[model samples]
Target chain A: LAKTTQPISMDSYEGQEVNITCSHNNIATNDYITWYQQFPSQGPRFIIQGYKTKVTNEVASLFIPADRKSSTLSLPRVSLSDTAVYYCLVGDVSNTGKLIFGQGTTLQVKP
Target chain B: DAGVTQSPTHLIKTRGQHVTLRCSPISGHKSVSWYQQVLGQGPQFIFQYYEKEERGRGNFPDRFSARQFPNYSSELNVNALLLGDSALYLCASSLIRVDNSPLHFGNGTRLTVT
Candidate 1:
């Protein structure tokens, strides 16, 4: 499993864009970068996933540089309801069931 | 089309006691995984089962064991529990064991050891 490092907490106001970066220097060639959002007292929800380049969905966008050693999750026009803990995981999702989650980045969306 | 579901949303047990937690995966999902989340920390993988067979096990002690039924439901059992066992037990399900198939998680069962 690739270890990931992220900010412990981030603060942002409504309508602003929030970007959280994760560093996985030991990422493997077969590993894919995935992000999940967890609200209080709830299970974490999948946000976006990518192997390289950029991938976007209705909720967020993931940008993986050419090196693939790091990735950033970009949230557009943040709102108070978007406040949650964001986790970045890198692994071979297809081959293994042991998905490792690190101490996620806590995003505080202020009103 | 319900998501993964866990039973006994909240439980309290004493040290040296045994407890069982149950989970029902989404319809048609064949893989189920269990995780333990301590307060203020990310979830830790405990076990994973696919088609009623154990696919992976975490670094947890033997006191923690799990089994999957033919219907793809799962049960996580803990024996001789300690205070450190208190945490949220989460169950996640996926349709298959391939690709980037994202896991669908349940609200989790909160266990408190006294």
Candidate 2:
């Protein structure tokens, strides 16, 4: 499994775009990049997943470089509600499908 | 459709004691995985069960174990718990036991070991 490193915390103002980058230098061949969001006390929610290049959804967008060494989760026009911890995970495909998590990036969107 | 659901919203246990947490996955989900989340940290994978068989286990000790029923409901059991065992136990369900499937998580059972 590839270990991921992200910013410990980040601050942003409302209506601004936020891009959080995650680095996984040793990503495996079958690893897929996925991002999840978690609030104060709820379970982590799936935001986006991409194998390569870019994947855009209604909530966010994920961009992966050709080397797959790093990825960015971009949230457009973020609001206060976007204040939460965002996790970037390298997909585990060893038949276990067990998820590995890192400290994650705490994004605080303020007004 | 309902998302994953876990029972015993909150629990408090003593050292050397044991605890069991239950989870009901979405109506048609067939794979269930368990995770432990400490305060201010991300969720750590514990175990994964699919079609009533154990598929994966994490770096946790022998005290941590889990199983999935034929119907896809799952149970996480911790024996001889320690203070460090106090954390949120989460259950995630996915439609299949494949790597590409995104996991749907439950609110989780909060366990406090005193």
Candidate 3:
């Protein structure tokens, strides 16, 4: 499991883009970076995932550089409802669900 | 399709007591995993089961055990509960073939140890 470090919290206004970066200096070769979002009193929801370069989905985009030691989750045009905790996880799925979640970055999207 | 579902949305137990939390995986999902989420903290992996077999486990004590049923449902058992055990218990399910697939989670059971 690759221990991930990320900002404790971030603040942004509605309609702004928010990017949360995670650092995994000890990422393994097979490790994949994934992000999740959670609202108060709810379970975390999958946001995006990537191995290297960049990957985008309807919800968010993941950017991983060539080094693969770090990844960034970009939420475009955020809204107040998007305020939630974002978690960055780096692990090998081949290890059979050894997901270790970090403390996560609490994004506060202001109206 | 119905997503993952957990029973007893909320529960209360005293120290040293035992509790069983249940979860029903989504239709066609063959794997179920349990996580413990303390207030103001991220969730910690507890256990993962697939094909009615233990596939993985976290650092939780032996007091915490789980098993997947024949129908792909799961039960998380906690014995000798402690105050620190009070937290939101989340159940996530996914197909075991592709581990990178997103995990579908239930609303979770809020367990309060008094």
The numbered model that scores best in lDDT is 1
Q: Which one wins on DockQ?
A: 1
The residue pairs in collision within model 1 are: none
TM-score of each: 0.98, 0.97, 0.97
Each candidate: what lDDT? 0.93, 0.92, 0.91
- Model 3: per-residue Cα lDDT over B23-106, one tens digit each: 999999888999999999998999999999989999999999999889999999999999999999999988877857767789
Model 2 DockQ (Cα-based)? 0.67
Cα error of candidate 3 at position B75, Å: 0.2
Residues B18-94, model 1: lDDT tens digits: 99999999999889999999999999999989989888899999999999999999999999999999999999998
RMSD of 1: 0.9
Give the candidate number with the greatest TM-score: 1
Q: How should the candidates be ordered by TM-score, best one leading?
A: 1, 3, 2
Model 3: per-residue Cα lDDT at residue B65: 97
DockQ (Cα-based) per candidate? 0.74, 0.67, 0.63
Off by over 4 Å in 3: none
lDDT of 2 at A61: 93
What's the distance in Å from true for residue B100, model 3?
Answer: 1.8
